[model samples]
Target: MSANDLPSLLSVALLARVGPARERLREALGQAGATLVLEEDPNTLELQVLRDAAPGAVLIALEPAIEDALERLDPVLGSPSLTLIFDEAELAARREGWEAQRWARHLVAKLHGHLDVLPPGSEQDGLLQPEPGLPTTPAQLHADAPLDFHVREAFDAAGDVPADGLYQAPDTLSEPMSLEEALAALQPPFSTPAAPSGPPPVPVSAPQTEPPRVPLGDHSSWSLVDDDAVAAVAPPPSATPSAAPPPSDFDIARLSLVDLEAERPADGAAAGAVLVLAGIGGPDALRRLLATLPAGLATPVLVHMRLDGGRYGNLVKQMARVSALPVLLAEAAEPVQAGNAYILPDDVGLAVRDRGLYFSADAQGVQVGTLPPSESAVVLLSGADAGQVDAVLALAGEGAWVAGQVGEGCYDPTAANAVVAAGMHAGEPPQLAQHIVERWGVSE
Candidate 1:
């Protein structure tokens, strides 16, 4: 062991089966800034032994055999004073060299206190390459972006407001004047001419002149010009256009895919699955959820994330990189399937058929009726539309495992908040994923 393996400030209790795993974990705990107070197989460890040790933290080397070991050590495991750390024995046994050192550093950080555990300076994926040049700001750009035109125009269109500010009481305020006196101060059209305050003179009216009767002469006013020099650029009268060949007899779909029954949504009925809805800031939540989902998930995870410019294809590729299951674009008229994730586009809509759901173009948004209320689940993630909150709650009322992403890392929590307000489960992406797996009883 290196010098870093010296006893740490914190004391830790290790619970693992008596074997190479226990031996390795014993060494690892020492290297990970922890002093071992007790090391025993959880299956046989006495409750008194844990109480006597009373370590500040507990390290559990997890494996299939120790699935119920925590139950045996429930008293220690449930202690509020002790921090519990679990790591896969298989994965821990494989760690060596740099991997072992990195794990130790992370363990130390966790044992002590830190915000985020990460590489020293940057992401492990790759180094940050600085750009050679930065984008030039347009010279004509306004200091402040223009506001709504209606708001700007509303202030001055009627000329009600002055340049300086709102009008104030005039210093020379006058008493109320008579109606006629008020009218007399205005202009001729504005005022009523004061009704001519004298004897009525002979009513003089302007003469109505009859329109002149001018006889129309065809081509007389029109100029008759001699033909100027012209070149022969007209199409030849002898030229005849050739006819197009008839559509090939081999044509089967009648020149339109609509004629094919196989292409319609009803032909491929929906196979009910889990529906996950999100918008902005959803991709990261999706990554965590998909990453934690256990293998061999029977139901399909349909991700409906509305993106600008209909970038579903790009989304599918990005998700496929992180997702354990194959990511596919939800095509129109295709039935929802199992064992894979489908990225639903804006145009693709849902329809229920025989208690199942399928994608179609006739509608938009989640069709609550199409979803098997009892069988289907709805997970509202970050940036999900709040409009669907009622629908998800309705499903929840009908026995669906409706959930919302917790406030953490959620950019727009309107929808999730609504679901949570309605008393649905709210959790982080991984926690939600675990609930879903457990609900389906398909997780290992």
Candidate 2:
């Protein structure tokens, strides 16, 4: 089946273990546009009911305790047409903030077989599109044009003067007051009559003489002096002379050129390893790819899949069930070995050191561009994030063997499609597996 052939509405049978996890999964499936045809507990699920309901897909929230129940439902599991999806129970229980957003995206990708799941009213057609012509320039102000009515009225009012020429009145005013009349109204009336003023007194005669200066020698007690007293005092010296500590032998060797050369990885050896990046519909794709890999493959496999904090344990167990090689969660400071598949944790970064992989506590996590391109094989699987496309392309340009999952199986091919468009290898999960097997020359 091709991606174009995917059903618009999926009738899903949910055989999930009951808890907050099951409810969270149900909500996510609803958001992804999946119609729940039947919901039943994994413990009590019967093959007859599954046949009767006839759902297109069966979503199972795998828990460690439900292995016995799954074994009994082998008949339903064996159906070729049914798409079996296994999710870690604890991971599905996370339904808050960014975790909820990621869970919804993954759920939609798994059920709808595509990454472009938008909310009801968020369709591109509903958005306002820009007008086809150039934007209309704002109407320019004309300097030669007449002033606005209010501005002209303000200028005319200021210029209008009364007949006295001492006061200006607004054109709207009926009467204007004179400056003399306004001042006379503000002054108080003289109540008592003033006595007859005597004749003005004669101007006083003036005699001026210059004052004399005193000699500096007359004040003998006060003298000007420089601050030479402070310079006379000296700071105290140390009680004993101390010698510097002798340089250590260890420090001398560390600075030598031999030490720097020893740190680098050997030339002509495989500096690169296999890196697998996936998201939403990656679990099944990963399982299919891992199953075809030989037991003693030379290239070390590193997998980075988006999952909740506590889901790594369950994922390792689930992948081991179908993978031909051992699947294990990668640990910090551990060396990457051949034939074993390592699942990368979300909180750490993976790096190559001494020809082996090592993990660091980097919040940004493992970046694809940080790996050595000449020695690495990168597989872009289903549901890979679109944000990592550029980094993956850079790796391809640096001579890394890059492959992407294509066709119906890749529900979220956003990152994979980017790699394919850049002229890298493109194929389904099984074909990707075959490519890796042949590239590394595994004795399969």
Candidate 3:
């Protein structure tokens, strides 16, 4: 069926070895916006029963226990209208909380053909990303007109300052002081004010030295309700008045390459490999992505996602089931092949040579800095470390095609979001695969 003809709420058939995994799969599918047509244990289910239900998709929680039963339903697996998705039963049974919710969002996105799962950040992800016409730089935050208007408004309103700015006249002042004396007593100490009135006036007899301090937060006042810590929260004003400093302490200029080192690509280095870095919600993403890749991609796919359990052998097997390319666990001192997938751990890394790169156990992880940027590519997926963001961006600056995962399924997109924020490309796994094919062109 054409993509446009796909259903809004896909009818799904659930098959598993009748246990907690089946129930978890049922709930997860429902949460992902799927309508369950049939839920049955694959070991006891009949093929004709599944065919008669006519589900748009079939979700199989695979395990060795149900292997023979699944083989009996091979005919149904080949149906054009049916989309078969296999997930690990152990993973499903254990999935819970936010991780399960993230998986559900990605599943719905896959079924519905949309990527709207937002990153777990403030609701204001787009706040700093203003359109072209809007203010982008710090100096533009206050421009000449707005600053003049605000300063003049404050100065003009300062004349009508009320008696005893924040502190009221003490009920039992031992000295029974005058109104001016009481006001003076509360002046400097009670610098910040509250109430629905203009702020207490500072005597402008001498020229005001320090530039005006901004309000504590987004509120339109110089006061903060935090009584316990009286320390200043706002940054002190800069000496230069010609150009306005950043509105907040964080300057966007920090991301610029002004302070970074200048490293050129090696003179005669050849194209190395396609490197993928993922975490948290990455296994599913990697599985889906690897399944679409052609066998003769002619570039080693070096996957460097860390699994806490160090199940690299299991990862290799999982990827091999879906991948057209030969997926293998990186071995010590082995020559990196042209069209194979390597699941490299932190201890293993590439050993650069005159011919090409090789997997070396002696090396300390895959170092992107050692690769020729012009001939390399880096893709950051969910849960990728933000610490490598600077190095990746530097490579992008040197002509490497860099991309980040955008949309649902990527649970921790901290590194991915950082890449996208810096104007790098962002898309779903399949979209990125297509780009890879288009950019590098494929073989037989």
- For candidate 1, the 10 contiguous residues with the lowest summed lDDT are 226-235
lDDT (tens digit, per residue) of candidate 2 on 1-444: 444778676788888878988898788777667889989897998878888998988888866566667767867766667777777575577656666666677667767766564444565554667889876554544545666987978888975744775555444433367777666655657889877699866557643555588543323333355568444542244333345466666655456455443443333223557999998778878987987887887777888887744467666766776677889888776666667888888876776667646666677778888788887888989888789888888888989999999975576788899889889999988788888888887744
Backbone clash count for every predicted candidate, in the order shown: 1, 1, 0
> Higher-TM-score candidate among 1 and 2?
2
Instruction: Give the local distance difference test score of model 1.
Output: 0.72
Q: Positional deviation of 167 in candidate 2, in angstroms? A: 86
What is candidate 3's lDDT per residue for 47-109, written digit by digit as tens? 899889999888888665776677678678666577777776877788888877877776776
- State, as a TM-score between 0 and 1, how close model 1 is to the true structure: 0.41
Model 3 regions more than 4 Å off: 1-24, 30-270
> Model-by-model lDDT, in order?
0.72, 0.75, 0.76
- Model 2, total clashes: 1
What TM-score number comes out for model 3? Answer: 0.49
Rank all candidate structures by their TM-score, best first, as comma-separated numbers: 3, 2, 1
When 1 and 3 are scored with lDDT, the better candidate is 3
Highest-scoring model, TM-score: 3
Candidate 3 overall lDDT versus native: 0.76
If both were scored by TM-score, which would come out higher, candidate 2 or candidate 3?
A: 3
